[model samples]
Target chain A: MLDEQDKNVIRELQKGLPLVSRPFELIAGRLQMSETELIERVRSFERSGMIRRFGAAVRHHDLGYTANAMVVWDVPDGAVDEVGQSMAAFKEVTHCYQRPRHPGWPYNLFTVVHGRTRDECVQISEKISKKTNIANYRLLFSTAELKKSSMRYFE
Target chain B: MNLDDVDKKLLKLIQADLPLAPEPFREIAESLGIEEAEVIGRVFNMLEAGVIRRLGAIFDSRKIGYTGTLCALKVAVDRIDEVSAIVNSFPGVTHNYLREHTFNMWFTILAESKTKLDEILDTIRQSTGVEEIISLPAEKVFKIRVSFELD
Candidate 1:
């Protein structure tokens, strides 16, 4: 739970830190607080797990990572935890989750894999499959990115 | 933009976490054995080239009292544009993509509450007139870190 002041800090922080020597000082001035107070609040948020990460959001596509695939697997319900952890250990697997299975959608475990080429993505998926022994899976490659933006909470 | 060795090292460091201090970039520069101005210059170049989409805090949606879900919708080939436009109109929709599958359109949306999430989904369905929409909420998030090695 966040008070109004904390929310205000987050709203400004989300816009991004200024690329200056003393970015926090500039932000603190706008929020009507001291630089030390602003940094302390941000550190507290990170410690509390409210701020999951505080760093650069790199666009993988621009870094020559053009191949991206969402690999969905139908691991046995009893072995999902073990298999999901194994899948996540791969450096290529950026995101892994156990999503609810819908009607006609038997896949429960989802992993987003990225690579420099389509073949590289396939090879990584095969490696993951061999490691996890989850054969019932399909790869859904993204044809187009319609929208990709961070969530604006306070606005 | 071509990334030199220094740029690669800097990207990897900044991708993890910027130091929480009065002069955070200076700390990064000290560790990288470079001047603070050089570090700032590289970051600025990457931003200009669209390599770094943002440099800021990433909040945990659930921890922050928000609910989110991933949805996939099946649409006729000709109506893909119309259906996707309706789906992407909602501010809650953070990621919308056209994937290659029967359920061709996929997106992830976040809302303040479960009710609000469902209402947004319902409105998208009604507006698009697409009946085959499935929402797959995460039962367990095993991992969600996205870090790329530039080596």
Candidate 2:
């Protein structure tokens, strides 16, 4: 149960915090609240899991890890937790998930692998496959990123 | 263009959590034993270079009462651009990508409800006229709520 002020805070935060000596002061000033109150609210948000994380969203591609692939696996339902945990242990595997499987879509587990080259990405996936022993998988390399933006809940 | 040790250190620090304070950058600088201005300058440079997409709060859509699904479409290669634009037009579609697979176009849509999410997906399918579409909702998020370590 968030108040209007909290929503306002979230809306402003969704855009981004200012890069300044006192970002919360800037935001708190705009919201007409004390800096301590605003900071406490933000801390509460983090504790309540409203905010996943509060920091820089680094673009991995710009970090020189251009090679990226969404590797989807058809892991056995019984072994999904075990395999997912195994795959997620890799340093390059950033996002791992258990998505529902449709009729034509047999792949249920997905993990994002980032590397310097396509070969590197494939090699990472191969290593994960060998480690997890989940052979049925597809490396869906991104051909083009048409749109990539954070979800705007308040706006 | 490789990052110097300082830049690497700054990046590793910034990627996770910035101290919630009057001067978060200064706190980061203190940890690294660098000038606050230097920390700010490097972050700005990285942002300008597209290394840091944005410095902000990352929210959990589910916790915020948003329902979403990952959709894949086998669009024609020639119509990829057109279809992508149509998909991207929806504000709910946060991520749209052309992937190397039979289902070439993939995107994630988030809405306030399951009904709204389904409606958005239906609208995209109706407008795009792409019959072959697959919607994969998250059954279980085994490893979300985490960030990648830059070290």
Candidate 3:
């Protein structure tokens, strides 16, 4: 568990690292710690899996990856793990997860696929279906991004 | 802005992780065989172009004692903007989108606890008066990596 000071470090780091020759030095100066201490703390966080990633958050739309689809599949309960891992191996799939199926919603496996065009997204989904042999699926394309912001933890 | 080969390479490098060094950019410059200033300048330009949303640490909410869930609401066509505004007002509500489906508005919310998550969902339901909100919590995460290869 992170203490108050660790939370403070996270708050500062999440705002983003300064673009400079010695970015960590500047951040550590503000955090009232040595540069080495700050780096070590971040490294520890990375090692402990607290920090999922520590780098650029690229906007896919801006990068011409405008076509994004949420492809949900109804994989057999026992085969979900196998099918999910197979689908996740594709470079096009960014996020893949297994969620509980609702009364009316039969799809339990979800994967968010990104492509440059709508047809490209469809092709990727088709490819995944072919590989997984799970034909029961539906692609829900996002019409608009109402909001897309990083979670501000400990705020 | 057109991205040259160097910018593409620099982006790919920065997308992974900045080196844990006194001068991280300098380390990156060494790998790419470019001046540190060039890297900083390219990143600045990319930021201006909105190619890079942010450059920071992405914490695992679960590891940090936070609970998150994806929800889809069956909202009426005319109420999208108003409903979205209400949903987006909350700080915990992130990645809200209007998808092409019956349950049009889909979003992911992260809260400090499961109770907090339920509270937020209840509040959103009450505020929007949209009864058909389905909360889908992940039972297992197969993959959650986002990296765009600039070819």
Question: What value of lDDT does candidate 2 attain over all alpha carbons?
Answer: 0.87
| TM-score for chain B of each model, two decimals | 0.97, 0.92, 0.96
Candidate 1 versus the native: TM-score?
0.98
DockQ (CA atoms), all models = 0.88, 0.75, 0.87
Rank candidates, DockQ, best first: 1, 3, 2
What tens-digit string does per-residue lDDT give for candidate 2 at A19-108? Answer: 889999999999999989999999999999988888888877766778989999999999999988888778888889999888888999
Clashing residue pairs in candidate 3 are none
DockQ of 2: 0.75
Position A44, candidate 1: lDDT: 96
Which parts of model 3 have CA positions greater than 4 angstroms off?
none
Tens-digit per-residue lDDT, B113-139, candidate 1: 999999998899889999999999999
Q: Provide the lDDT at A119 for model 1.
A: 94
The alpha-carbon deviation from the true structure for residue A154 of candidate 1, after best TM-score superposition, in angstroms, is 1.5
Expressed as tens digits, the lDDT of each residue in B1-151 for candidate 2 is: 4678898888888887889888999999999999999999999888888788889788888877888889999999899888888899989899988888888889999998999888888898899999999998888776763455555
Instruction: Give the CA lDDT, 0 to 100, for residue A60 in model 2.
Output: 74
- Alpha-carbon local distance difference test for all models: 0.93, 0.87, 0.91
